[model samples]
Target: MFFSPLDQFEIKPLLILNNSYILSLSNYTIYFILVILIIYGYTIIFKNNKLSSNRYGVAIIALYDTILNLVVSQIGRQGGYYFPLIFSIFNIIVISNLLSMIPYSFALSAQLVAVISLSLALWIGNLIIGLYIHGFKFFALFVPSGTPLALVPVLVLIESLSYSSRAISLGLRLSANILSGHLLLLILGSLILSLISTSLIGFIGGIIPVIGVVAIVILEFGISIIQGYVFSILLSGYIKDSILLH
Candidate 1:
């Protein structure tokens, strides 16, 4: 297969599937498959007789690093219940984001389908879980429990708007960051390559941008993990508020 500065979009070698509707195998599909395999492998590992006593503990570690970061960062002692949904989003985004770090692998995080799906999944899942846990009282999230009735309607409308906006905010935050990082790397690589093709002076000029890109890459790498944590932590807070009527 051919390689490019932005080739992470290609289908991974492990998965084989036909696509009549789309031209290429979806990156998100492959990412989810990886997630499944990791979880499945962990399940088998923990099933060994010697390790069976720690299966519950091992299962948590197997899911997603993003989820663990979130629980540790936000929920503290209260993160247990939200692990499943949080883990799914965390694993998908982390895998998608990290894949783009490698040259020629598709950047699933840069695609709207992947990022938007993550945000929507979290938003809808939170709402459903909240309703299931708290019944109609989950709507109470819009109005703080102690507020006077005169303030209730406005509070509800404002909170509802905020709630509805979560999907876009969450998706855009991650997708935009990943997209910007990839574009910056591609532009720098192009400039350096072009400069080398031309003359020594151009080649020297390319070094400046290359250095800048390297620094930015390191910074962005840390930010990627931070952003993933932020998404999960916010979800945890939302769940806490929705369920606790806070």
Candidate 2:
């Protein structure tokens, strides 16, 4: 039924209460709540159990340890204070992304507004943390270290722009990757479907395209985990920067 690749991103309300858009329960809400439940279930299932207890526990715990180590290395022992935040963000992204890979599931991270809002909030939180720790000196993050007073103004101006751009770039990077990958899969699937249905030779040749689709799907799965890890690493760095101001 999709006429365009972008049509996949169109959100439809499942329940519009009181004839008000504001009160509408959209598909996005459902997927988000589902993601939350899945994450909560994961915690309950894995948090209190031994890895040998469940078949999935080994892989899940390994993943938890990987992110755990990532935080500790990037932010040091104090990373424990923020590990939960990073872990939650990383799981939310990884779960939503993996969930979207399911046939007909909504891609929550593909929504620019949702992804950008989360990143923007984190960026603002970094500013607050920096201000809390360093006061007005936090603005010195724009100045770097040891520059001539004459070049300070020009360098500060450039650095300020770059610093602020993180608010948009962090989320844009994640959302753009998710959107483009899903779009590619959908387009390829559609093309192969048409090709295979056309004639005998086309059906035979569909094997390669089908193999390519499988390969890309595997790559997308890797991207889901890699993106989550990448976001965590960058956020850990930003938090470190906020605290250290170096």
Candidate 3:
């Protein structure tokens, strides 16, 4: 039986908690737990031991340093105060993306609902932080520096709209990238399967797409890492803007 390329994205219930409650165990829930466990394991492994001598430990330490530098550079010295949050976000995202690359594994990052919900929560949290720190002055974010009195209304409207769109855009960007990459892989794999199942000539023709599939998998791994970095950096920028009102 030929399954649809998108079938891999289906969220199947693994165990029903209560039929009436609409809460159940799913592949997503399983993978989500796996992500948390993986992060926790890494933290436990790298906790306070000398890492320079061990190759695996050194690599993990380097990753930590890289993330630390990223947060500090993007958000300034105060960024260290928020280092835990930034580090957690980066690790969770990158790990989840990497897990999705495993064959037959669910891609939590590709779920629009999950990504959008996370984006909205973080965006709202930033707003709350700004409001707590700056009070009414938080609204001043909608006004650019040195705006003429005449264009105040126009610029404020434009800025407000742009600012509000961040939640949608951030989540959409991650979901779109992962969804497209996986879709392409599924299509290519399906095509190769179909071709090889046919005559000898078709099997030979499938080699080209098989090569393309391999290339795309490598590209996808790089993109998965990059998307995590991009998400964290953008969040850092948002945090900085909220604190500095720039």
Q: Judging by lDDT against the true structure, name the best candidate.
A: 2
Cα-based TM-score, every candidate: 0.74, 0.94, 0.93
- What does candidate 3 score on TM? 0.93
lDDT for model 1: 0.70
User: Taking the tens digit of each residue's C-alpha lDDT, what string does model 2 give over 47-129?
Assistant: 56475577688778888899999999988988999999999999999999998887777889899999999999999999999
Number of backbone collisions per candidate: 5, 0, 0
Q: What's the ranking of the predictions by lDDT, best on top?
A: 2, 3, 1
Report the lDDT tens digits of candidate 1 across residue range 90-191. Answer: 655665566567667667777777678767877787788779989998887878768889988988899899889986788888888888888877887777
Which should have the higher lDDT, number 2 or number 3?
2
Clashes of 2: 0
lDDT of 1 at 143: 81
Alpha-carbon runs more than 4 Å astray in model 1: 6-28, 35-73, 76-78, 145-151
Better of 1 and 3 by TM-score: 3
Query: After best superposition, candidate 2 residue 198: deviation in angstroms?
Result: 2.2
lDDT of 1 at 146: 84
RMSD after CA superposition, every candidate: 4.9, 1.9, 2.1
